[model samples]
Target: MMNRHQLPDTLLMGYAAGALPEAFNVVIATHVSLSDEARARLAAFEAVGGAVLDDDAAEMAEDSFDRMMARLDMLPQANARVTEAAEGIFPAPLADYVHRDGRSIRWRSIGAGVKQAILRTDGRASVRLLRIPAGQAVPDHGHRGTELTLVLQGAFFDGNKRYGRGDIEVANEETEHTPIAEAGEDCICLAATDAPLRFKSLIPRLAQPFFRI
Candidate 1:
């Protein structure tokens, strides 16, 4: 059970309808894998969608089958054992995007003991994994668009709230926060942003373009 933050029904519905950007979908998929509550909620949405489709006598386009077949070719194979928990922290879905686990990632440092590995995604949005050392704070910033952050390991505090593993924080232009990883362990999070962030300070702003943050 996710105690603090859970994926909103709106986002879960969007994910069910296959309307979200691929990067966001990745984050949602991984979160669903980790949280039983999220998985159940997502399943409800999918069931609703399925019932709706069944009740509607919709005509399929002549090319629909061909298009679906093409899409299936692009998706994961039905028999692949890629969604289960790995020996490392990464679950199957995330590992499919990255690799087997943390060791497979080639981390890039961005100063202040923070490191990140940008995941390959479509140009519509960008996603990455952030490793914040214990007790260190990410630079204060606002969002230009939607941002989805999921804690994978350890914990962090932002806006007087604590987010631990499986907790997802959703932020938009109206949200601004400085997230600090808690002590005792490093915090690892998978973050997806639709647009670049709004930095409050000069150094991070200056370095933003270089990091493609």
Candidate 2:
């Protein structure tokens, strides 16, 4: 029952094909864990991929069959439980990375009643959790590359739209807006970015290097 927003079709397809960067994959996987509709859509893409493979005309080597079976045996079981470390707020895929209760998260202050915890990710892109107090506003900024942000709890309004739990905001260099958490509750978001943000304010621009936002 997703009510606010959904991942874009391009992102969904890239995730299904395993072609996204590690940071992007993490965001997609976590969103899928929370949205049954996303899961079904991803399954459809996988089915189409399988059908295409079945129609492949190239002949396989004699040892290919045995090697494939051996590889299957080496793969971990799909039903293995994610760690019990995370509170229910985190979906299982994200829980695997945090590996601790939400309250235990070490948050770093980023001014203006906002806090953040950077999550270790592969390559140039980065993933992190952000907590913004109710009514607080994130600095007005645009993206240098791409940014995918998923709301895990509460809500925020970014001038153009309101995003609540399970909503994802996809932004690129062309987009810039000040996101303000709604009045009643703090907004918790899982965000991934491929490059440094483009800040408008002089103070934010100066602090950008130190905060790595």
Candidate 3:
């Protein structure tokens, strides 16, 4: 169970309404796959949307109901089976993107015992996977826009709080901190950002263009 933090209600509603960008959608879907609480919340938001539609007074064509039923019949079931990753490391939605077990990830070293793999996503946002060695610290940085980081394995502490598996850190322009991985195991996180990060150190700022962190 997730204990650190939950996705913001605005994001949950956007996900339920299918209004989020592909990058945000991917992160939310993967998080929901890992957290029963998130899944239940998403269901509640969808239920609210359905109720709103039911109360709408718009007139419909004579065959609209039949067409809707036919479309529903053609749609794939919501509970359709997804191929599970080994040991359940990657959630089903994420597994579909990586198409491999976590250990088999093609990691590119980003220096300081950290590795990353960028994921292709639509729109202006960027998505990536970060693997930080035990006790290693990410460079101090602030956000230009918003960043959503979901812990897939192990844990990390960002001075103010500790985030473990299934937990999400919602960082925005107002936040700045260095995240250090907890000892004992590597910390793996899925992150999405809408703009370039604001690095405090000169080294990180200079390397930002090349690393795209």
Candidate 4:
């Protein structure tokens, strides 16, 4: 089986509430494809979210409930059946639209010690996999829009907070964070970056044409 990690509660909560962006949803879907156990946990969280929504029924807008129910009823059952059939096969293809070249990930180096590959480009932001070697730092960068990252393997410290497997970190224009992979193994993460990263180096500026990060 492929190495899998459980998601942090915060991310699970955001996913359950449907607050996560669409691009990030593709990464979550890939992780779901890899780990049934994690999917089951997220399912439970969704159930709890449903229960809470029910409990707050009185506060919900009248049309909001009807709209939600309408949308639910409108969903095609065929898609659910197809997904179930696909899950039975499990983890072989990496993901529906991702490029895979064997067990070890194929990475395109973007900066010093930072390598990435687009798992799936959904016409919006590319759903990407990133690896940073221990003690390696990325270009001290910020985002033009929201960025969502889910740690898959190893760990990294960003702005004093340590993120491990399954921890989803959200960054936007308001925040600036520089991450260095923790010592031991390479830090591998799945992220959906909505906008181009703003780099702070001349090397990154020159290399930007060759490497799209």
**Per-candidate TM-score against the hidden true structure:** 0.85, 0.84, 0.83, 0.62
Report the number of backbone clashes for model 1: 0
Pick the TM-score winner.
Answer: 1
Which lDDT tens digits does candidate 4 get at residues 1-213?
A: 112245566666777788776666776665665567768988998999889877853557769977998899777675434543343222333345453333445678886868897664545665677889987877687788767777777888886778887566767787677888889989887888778777877888777667666
Q: Summarize candidate 2's per-residue lDDT along 1-213 as a digit string, tens digits.
A: 122477777788888888888889889988887789899999988887789888869879999999999899788777566444356788878877776454467789877788999887787688999999999999898888888989999999987689988889888878877889999989999999999887888887887899988
Better of 1 and 3 by lDDT: 1
The clash count of every prediction, one per candidate, is 0, 0, 0, 0
Give, for candidate 2, the lowest lDDT window spanning 10 residues: 78-87
What is the lDDT, from 0 to 100, of the residue 17 in candidate 3?
93
Consecutive 10-residue window with the lowest summed lDDT within model 3: 79-88
CA lDDT, every model vs. true structure:
0.88, 0.84, 0.85, 0.69
The number of the candidate with the highest lDDT is 1
Model 2: pairs clashing at backbone N, Cα or C within 3 Å: none
The candidate 1 region of ten consecutive residues with least summed lDDT is 77-86
- Candidate structures ordered by lDDT, highest first: 1, 3, 2, 4
lDDT of 1 by residue, 1-213 (tens): 122588878899999999999899989998998899999999999999999889969779999999998898678657766345756777778888887353578889877899999988777999999999999999998988889999999999996899999899998888878999999999999999999986888888888989988
- Model 2 C-alpha RMSD to native: 4.0
